[model samples]
Target chain A: MPQTADTNRRVVLSERPNGLPDAKTLQLEHSEVPTPGADQVLLRTRYLSLDPYMRGRMNDAKSYAEPVKLGEVMTGQVVAEVMQSNCEGYAPGDHVLAGSGWQDYALSDGTDLRNLGQTPQNPSWYLGILGMPAYTAYAGLLEIGAPQPGETVVVAAASGPVGATVGQIAKIKGCRVVGIAGGPEKCAHVVENLGFDACLDHKSETFAADLKAACPQGVDIYFENVGGKVLYAVLPLLNAFARMPVCGVVSWYNLSGLPDGPDFGPAIMGTILRMKVKVQGFIIYDSFPPSLFKDFIRDMTGWLESGEVTYKEQVIDGLEHAPAALNDLLLGNSFGKMVVKVG
Target chain B: MPQTADTNRRVVLSERPNGLPDAKTLQLEHSEVPTPGADQVLLRTRYLSLDPYMRGRMNDAKSYAEPVKLGEVMTGQVVAEVMQSNCEGYAPGDHVLAGSGWQDYALSDGTDLRNLGQTPQNPSWYLGILGMPAYTAYAGLLEIGAPQPGETVVVAAASGPVGATVGQIAKIKGCRVVGIAGGPEKCAHVVENLGFDACLDHKSETFAADLKAACPQGVDIYFENVGGKVLYAVLPLLNAFARMPVCGVVSWYNLSGLPDGPDFGPAIMGTILRMKVKVQGFIIYDSFPPSLFKDFIRDMTGWLESGEVTYKEQVIDGLEHAPAALNDLLLGNSFGKMVVKVG
Candidate 1:
């Protein structure tokens, strides 16, 4: 809640971006707090999740999800509290995970809201580890990448929510997890905190060679999140029958146009053919069944409690910094899961 | 088996060519037929299978299979007559499938030979529809492609062995099959003889538009064998959750260097992510279980007998034509399966 409780502060897409979003791309606006109608709950956002996928939604391109229209509330997931409720299942003071976008308050009919009850432990976590990003990591690595016990799994954006979770899960599956991060600090965190076998900094001059050195047996499962230089480095190092579960391409998300080149499109295709690689692009919501989320929450909760899996989040206080935070997330400056403390 | 029966003629990789293999790329040489040692069978080549995978073996670059060295006999599969046998299943009149090179006479230790019994029907068929190419189509299509009924399947090199078999099998499974071939004649054969629902001439100026028109439902499964212009066309038309079973890239096989461009590499990866596509590259021999071949042969044999399937081979007469036949096969000139009649 801001100083003025009666005013609902929200961020709306003002314009589409050509490359990195400028300050004017998203505009902060104030309006009267929305009233709950029949069968609707008035929710006040406590935390708003800023993710790389939001960048794609900003583009007016054909993708898994529809792009956010100009002047519309920017699409996002938020962990919020119900201030008033006429909805049957959700009551006042209930903490619910809602697709409320980047806002202070929202009215929901309870269809997209996941009730977490009052005073839920680490309620903000619903926007990170116990929610979409971690779930994406779990499903993509287990279902598509299918990491084997002795196989090597290389993940990009290693300290980010999805990559960290993927690396940790791969470690749990007894795989050799090699992580690639943008900076030395994140790389260290991936190895020391997340318990990955090795973490290579993509910022290194010999990053590609470093990746090859880290995985001498060749990468069997590449949990692809960042798709520019990391992808190029990982391609030649992929073993026969390598599986690449592509969840994000944050590195290329802001690319307005293709870079000049001896186009490597054919070379990539040729390598895929010659190496017998399996590259699958997937959106977690579209790829996995809803029932799997329960299993995931159960297993992840157990893993967290047992000290087997760890999570880290860069929580930015105040919702006003979200636009800049998202830019940092896309540029690989965020050390881990990037989230906003809205209230 | 030849005009000079005692002379064993073989084609050796005289030199590796930059673009396409020219007259100087392979050299024909004559030698006295070697005597078979104990447990070895003296085989006289009857038919040699000329498939596109051979193009990859000509390059020195590392691939699934080792490259054919400078002075080594050009690698290929052959249906041959067992002229002499010293051990176990001793027979002189038996026909067998052997990993014999481009030579009339070769000694196999029976380890790599599959005995086809004397007086088998259409012995040359063993080098084609019953062998690697057709089996590749069967496994790649059914296993990886996994076409559902009424779904659209777009296959390139649609008149060639793999593509033809894939389209036919997709039809058997109740798919709307679209075939893409180089010219009008081959496209006609793909639709009429191969029983595909539609065939688009890839040589047409409006090939991309023609493909879009032909596949009104968009491509659900793309049985990718040729991956140049055809791949460029298919990428945009792919439906969500589309599966691409990449079996070959004959178009890029002869390329000495990559084409200059504003690189489409990032665009390809972006499409893969946005469309949620599955692209799997595979070599038939490496992908399937050994037992599946028996199942394939049985099912394929039944389909042929019941008139549910058909096969065509452009059999080039003379062992001397094997080099040119392989060149033709890579160039997409030979219609259907290209085989050299060695006997």
Candidate 2:
């Protein structure tokens, strides 16, 4: 069943799901490996990054980025080996960061492909801590949240890549960080391993009360990636002039519609007005400047080397298991950064 | 009643209303005029400024500023003429801006009074165009909204002081300004007199469609004062990186609770995330520094003198009519700035 040069294994969008996506949403098929034309490079994907934003691409709704078309290759970011090259600066056996989709091999024009060079300590690190998730945490917390010393910083999905990075950075900046996670185990990991001041389990029956008890001075900066109950609890605990850098709303991503009423829109708007809160949303690439990435890379590398920052990844074995892994991510069943080792 | 130096007429908060304030909410009573102490100044009220924020002060709920206590004189801003002076910077016939409450006469210990020189073109202008409302528009729009040339700026309560000033300033910045008002007359005034590119009547059956039609390029900045329907309409029309300076939520101020079901909080947050919107709330005095006031005064004075900025006021005749005038303001019945001529 091994793929030859004449055939490639790939996953394509079969159908859009109504709520949580299932096996029927994606179809695995075999196709002829794409041939690289002039100025193009052929890539064999080694590791594929799975992120929450990909869920948004499944819907037909208008967003900052376009949705993945039906029956087309499912879009994703990958760390790949340049198998063959007809373009300058690319050579056989070189690794690269490419948008090679959910496939064993892809053809790139070398236009947007980034050369990761001949060797990396851990190439999979480029898919997590040294990649998009970490960059989102860095730019959003520093640029938008702007946490001052001794301020209270709270973030949801505490054990995940973005949230873990946010909490750790806030600690480095001398702030009290409270993290919200789904289970007691993740909460323990957030506090003991990630250095957050306190971690609350959102699944607890007295979650709201626990969160309030944890944030004695109220929340000054709320790094919002998960919405729903966590957001509702955070709203009341937000201090005056709180800054919220909203990067995702993973909790509601699978829901077909809003929950039942008394509509909380007015309450949210009213709280924002009364407290003078600043709530802003952003995409990592949109706000972070290309020039600033050099600084980010330098700082993050130092932090990792010094053990000031620690990272965890949930590695799924094969590309065919991506659909199930994505479901686990949406349901909060996956820990840390979720990635598929596809080599 | 006319020549009473012995008795002073003052209004007090009788009871907090369930929703909107009525005649029963405030009670006027006569009491003996108190004598001023050594460092105190005695003043007779000239023009009393009635603003929308006073509605928040009437509520028992928590807010940025303290609520007015039951049976205390209803808090307000006033332009008063000094009848007697025992303070260093005050003299007879001096006009000062004071938080003197709704009354015919009051005694000040000179703590929060600002001395306004004897004569000016219009003393009441300090309560509107030259004062808090104008300053709010200046700081919120310029500092937060940051509307650039060729961008579109939208504001609600079109003919009122805050909205009018915001639109005019946006025009001065070379932006396309669209305003939302309650009626045809106010809409006409916003377009013809204030020079807004277009003004939509929120009271119209097709208000949402009309708003979309008016804003062909989508809204870049939304100066939100009136919430409810106006906010709902503006949400979908906001462009990527849209900035919303939430100054007030007048439309929802009188509501006892949130409106019925399928909660829109998730929808609002989702839109914010997808579009990368920035929504911030602010109170004028909290954000603007005193040093910036000098610049604002100079710029506004020049604009007024050059006929680039015009204003309107709905003057109510007596101190007895202040409650009714405030009700008119809350209900959107008042066409412009609501002021009471008390002297």
Candidate 3:
């Protein structure tokens, strides 16, 4: 079942899922390789970055970005190499960061592609630490959370790219960083490797008490990514004048409708008012001024080189494994930054 | 009964209310009028401001400020005239804005009083248009809501002091302001008198539809004060990157506990993430820098003098009417700023 020279392989949206996505949601299809039109470039994807945000794009619901249409190639960011170029600035063999999606090859007009040049230290790194997730961690934390020295910063999904980066950055800024992860192993890694002051396993029955004990001063800034029980636990622990930069709520992505219970809306509102907390939701690109990205790159690169910031990648080989990998990511089974090695 | 010259009439917190304050919550008492000590001033109250936030201070719950103690004069801001002074800066007959609470007479150490000097025009104006409520509206709208010109800014409790001030300021900033009020009369006042672009009656069955029709561009900034059904309706209409400066939730102030229903917390979190909205809750003084107050006073005074802002007051005649006036304010029966003429 190897692809022919004239053919391109892609994963397309087969059907929309009701709650969690399954294997049947996406289908692999083969078509004649698209030719580069005038002012267009042919891109061969080397790595496809799989993120929790993709779960949102799968639904035909209104969001900051449009949902992927059924029978269309699944949208994603990819580290790709230019195969053929009809665009003036792009040339064959040049590496780039582009929204080539879940595909073997894509036709781009070079409008949105970022040239990574002929060779990058690690091309796939551009898809994770040097790309959107890192930028998200930087912008959301520094701009919204605005953690100060002696403040306690808490983040969920501690081993994941965004949370790991956020916790480390907080540590670098002379703050107490506590991470919330799902298992003991992840928790240990978060504290031991990521330099977090403490890491609490949210799976434990005493998770709330553990978090309270760990953050003696109460949480000043909560980098909210996972919402549900974690959010509920974080709510009471949030100190007066706390800042919650909500970049994602991956846990609630699969919910069909409102959960069955006494509404917590009033309590949430009450906490917000009584504590004078600032809970701001933002997408990285929406909030980040393009000028800040240059600073982000310089600082992040230095941190990476100094070993102050470490990143882990769960590389699932082949584009065909993307569906199962994405499902694993949503299930909290993926250990780190989940990226598909497409080429 | 007429108060004797030697006795001071005061309202005290008799007990904490479970849901809403009633007749038994506050007890009227009389005490000997205290003589001013060294560096102190004796004051006779002229006006007492009644606000919905006082309802929160009645509860034995943790909040930004401490609850009113049992059998202590109920906390409030007042416009008062100095009767005697041992303090260097004060003199008899001087008007001042002070936290004198619900009482006919008080002795201040001249610490927190803002001297208004002798017979200033409308001294009670400091308790409404020139004071805390106006400051709340100014700081929250300009600092948090940050409404830009051509953007649609929505606010609730449209004719009340804070809401009225917020709408007028938004209008001054060239934003298209839409107000949500309880009745047609209040809505009419909001649009015609307060200079809002449109005002919707929340009591109408087609309220949500009316809001939609009025906000054709969708809501860009929601100055959240009334946070029950009004908030629910506004949630769906919030545009991408919308800013919600949550200054109050007066509608839920009287609830004994959480409302019974399927939990909308997850839905709120989801909407926040998908729409990339910014929801920041703040208390006026807590969020505003002290330096901003001078600028606020200068600009607000200009606005008032130019007829760019107008205000209304529902003034009760006596100190004994304070509790009922507060209840009326919370119940949305009070037309505008609720105050007690205590002199």
lDDT of 1 by residue, B17-54 (tens): 88889999999998999999988889999988888888
DockQ values per model: 0.80, 0.79, 0.72
Q: Model 3 TM-score?
A: 0.97
- In model 3, residue pairs whose N, Cα or C atoms come closer than 3 Å (at least 3 residues apart or on different chains), thus clashing, are none
Candidate 2: tens digits of C-alpha lDDT, residues B60-117: 8778899999998999999888989999999989899889989989999888988887
Q: Which of the predicted structures, 1 or 2, would earn the higher lDDT when compared with the native? A: 2
The candidates, ranked best first by DockQ, are 1, 2, 3
Best by DockQ: 1
Q: How far is B43's C-alpha from truth in model 2 (Å)?
A: 1.9
Report fnat, model 2. 0.77
TM-score of chain B of 3: 0.98
Task: Considering the two chains of model 1, state its CAPRI-style docking category.
Answer: medium
Candidate 2 per-residue lDDT over residues A133-187, each given as its tens digit: 9988988899999999999999999999999999999999999999999898999
User: What lDDT does the true structure give each of the candidates?
Assistant: 0.90, 0.91, 0.90
